[model samples]
Target: MSETNSQQNINTAVTLLERYAEGKRNFSEANLGNADLQGVDLKGSDFSYADLNEANLNGANLRGCDLSFANLSQANLQDADLRGALLFSADLRQADLKGAKLEKADCDRSTHFPQDFDPAQVGLQIKDG
Candidate 1:
């Protein structure tokens, strides 16, 4: 990820998560690239078109969330609950999706994936353009 936005993303991630505790949701287009958000319960939040490259979102509860077109390349998304989430055109190349619950998640051919990863094998629904 680019370091230009990394510093701001650090503070944003912390403050954002803190606010989430107080019931704040809509975080669309946030500059959270390279943020460390591991194990956060951000279910049902909006993260569309956000710059989340290399973010540590491991074990996060992201069920029913909107992540369409978000940049998640190289992110640590291990064990994350992404069931029924929107992932259309999301860049997920090299992301660690091991054990993530992708059942019913919507993605399109524009969504990037790891070389060996198969969205169909993981129960992700292919969205038509």
Candidate 2:
């Protein structure tokens, strides 16, 4: 995507998130496909069931964010901090999670990880709970 387009997308996402925080708008299942949200501070944001397919989330600080059931297929999440984030049932197929931090992230059967990914490399420990 072009620089202008990327900026526009980021602006739109920020606006939407601000609206959601203030209760001015509701994006319960909004489609944010292919948006560039790199380096954004979206901590504690609610993105449950949102369509985030192919979104660029590199270096984003998403600690404690709610992403339950969100579609994150092919999303760029490299080096993103997702500690304590709620990612239950989130679709992560083909997503680039290289060097991402997922400590304490909620994962289940529906959560998808790359085929050759080492959970320990990303600080993820699969426990039998």
Candidate 3:
């Protein structure tokens, strides 16, 4: 990433963290790639089109979050609450979803998965358009 882009990312992460601390949870299209946000309470946040690849989101409260088109590849989402999350077209390749609660989360054919990953086994529903 360019230095400018890197700086922008840092600023965005800090802003999001501050807003989260102030009880603001709507963060649509936020660029949070590679950020360490483990154990954060972000329920109902809108993360659509956000780049969360390689981020540590373990144990975060992401229920009802809009994660459609987000890049979550290689992210640690273990034990995260993802119920009702919109994951259509999201890149989840190599993401650690072990023990994650994905019940009723929306995914579709456009959603990429890691090798041997099974959404159905984890109660993730496939939404057909």
Candidate 4:
């Protein structure tokens, strides 16, 4: 990515944090690709239709969040709390989910998980496509 593009991504991350801190949770259709957002608590937030490809969300709290149709490909979700989150049609291929809490989470058949990762193993509520 170009320097300007990288700077834009940084700015987006900062803005997102600020907005969340201000009691805002509707982040649908946000472009957060490659943005670093580790260790943030955003429970029950709305991130539907967002582009989070390659973003760093390690240890973030996303419980009960709506992530339907989001692009989380190659994202770092290590140790994140995603219990009861909605991930319909979300693309999680190649994403790191080590130690991530996914119990009670729900996903449609369109959701793409990492290789060898089973949603049923994690107690996810798998829905038919």
lDDT of 2 by residue, 12-115 (tens): 57666665466532344657788888987777777777888998999998888878888989999999999988777788888999878898877776677778
Question: On residues 43-92, what C-alpha lDDT tens digit does candidate 1 reach at each position?
Answer: 99888888889999999999999999999999999999999999999999
Give the number of the best model, judged by TM-score. Answer: 4
lDDT of 4 at 94: 91
Query: lDDT, candidate 2, residue 26?
Result: 32
Candidate 3 pairs with clashing backbones: none
The parts of candidate 4 lying over 4 Å away from their true place are 1-11
Question: Candidate 4 — which pairs collide?
Answer: none
Better of 2 and 4 by lDDT: 4
What tens-digit string does per-residue lDDT give for candidate 3 at 1-129? 554343234325567778778776656556787888899888887787788989999999999999999899999999999999999999999899988999999999999988999999999999888
- Ten contiguous residues minimizing lDDT sum, candidate 3: 3-12
| Each model's lDDT | 0.87, 0.75, 0.85, 0.89
- 3 or 4, which is superior by TM-score? 4
Off by over 4 Å in 2: 1-11, 20-27, 125-129
Error of 1 at 125 (Å): 0.3
- Provide the clashing-pair count of each candidate structure: 0, 0, 0, 0
Clashing pairs in 1: none
Residues 1-129, candidate 4: write the lDDT tens digits.
553333233237888888788887888877999989899898998888888999999999999999999999999999999999999999999999999999999999999999999999988999886
What TM-score do all the candidates reach, one by one? 0.88, 0.77, 0.86, 0.89
- Error of model 3, residue 89, in angstroms: 0.3
Best by lDDT: 4
Candidate 3 global CA lDDT score: 0.85
